[model samples]
Target: MRLILLGPPGCGKGTQAKLLSRRLDLEHIGTGDLLRAAIRNTTPVGARARPFVDTGNLVPDDLVNELVAERFQRTDRPSRFVMDGYPRTLAQAHAFEQVLAQWKLPVESVILMNVSDAEITRRVTGRWSCPTPNCKATYHVENNPPRVAGVCDECGGRLIQRADDNVDTVRARLKVYHNDTSGLIPYYRQRGLLSEVEGSGSIEQIYASILGILQPQGG
Candidate 1:
């Protein structure tokens, strides 16, 4: 079940990835977590990524590509995995292709979660998170609000909306996402491995759709 999940910010890629990984018994490889672990372990790649990460700048495509390569090249590398938040651009996708070829771990499917920009804005802007270092619980205004408004039930910490989750920032992120994926989506489609799933439905509904695609009538 080697797979890649792609979507704009706030489209629930992470949620879907977790669900699919659990149900399919596949390791979930998320780039953000990958970078964080690399940096925490102070690996050579982490050292190079720290500056950009510290400054809130996007890591170079080559460096991110290397991170993915490093993981796949490991002797105990994941044999079945779901990749999320990776190969974000065409260049990264090509780099990943080379790594997959070298490792003989061709991806079976690439699922693109499609949601409107307006829906993304509403989704992101409605999120609030507990800022306590130990209790970083998140909540969505409509989907899962706290018992008391603006208060964390577990820690009683005042919930704060991350700057990146603001409407303007989310819109900007969607724009960048569209630009990067413009070619990436087509590349996968041409390879006959792309599957588009509507991302506006409930999490279970979306997960069911993905399962249906992965496990068709006789597949």
Candidate 2:
């Protein structure tokens, strides 16, 4: 059940990873979450990564690889896992392969959630999040607006759009994604481990599609 879920920003990779991990009883290993935890815990790797993360720049490949390598080497690492956000570049992908080889943990599949740029822009730019530290409820300006304008329904906290979710930032992120991460599609496809899933449908529908691909025939 080991898998790598790949997609551009706002393509629902996080949501799908959570769903798949819960349904199959596998650990969901999201790189963003991992980095945040490390930073919060002040791990050595996190110390090295903080400068770049604070500056809104991509963490160097070496630092990211080190972080991932450390995670994979954890004594409590899950036997089965879903990787959500590592390997954002071809170099990272190669580094990840090396890590997996060293760890003797071969990936079973790489799921790419395909979505158009326009749709992604719409989804990401409309997103807003609660400002309260403990209550981070999310809403969209259109699809799932908060009960009251600019306010979180659950805690009455002000809703703020993340700077990274702005149109300009999202476009920049998408550019990087297409230029770098997209190459992994062909890389994995050539190895016969790539599976494409439509990312625009209902969450349940998309989850079902992923399950269909991962499940054994007629199982």
Give the best candidate by TM-score. Answer: 1
* Model 1 stretches astray by more than 4 angstroms: 132-137, 152-157
- What TM-score should be assigned to candidate 2? 0.86
- Model 1 weakest 10-residue run by lDDT: 162-171
In candidate 1, which residue pairs get closer than 3 Å at backbone N, Cα or C atoms, i.e. clash?
none
Task: Estimate the overall C-alpha local distance difference test score of candidate 1.
Answer: 0.91
Question: Which residue pairs of candidate 2 clash?
Answer: none
RMSD (CA, Å), candidate 1 to true, equals 2.1
1-219: candidate 1 lDDT, tens digit per residue: 899999998898999999989988999998889999889988788889999999999988899999888888778889899999888999999999899999889999999999999999988899999999999999989989999999998999999988788877887899999999999999999999999999999999999999989999725
Residue 5, candidate 2: C-alpha displacement in angstroms: 0.3
Worst 10 residues of 2 by lDDT: 70-79
Give the Cα lDDT of each candidate.
Answer: 0.91, 0.88
Models 1 onward score TM values of 0.90, 0.86
Q: How much is 68 displaced in model 1, in angstroms?
A: 0.7
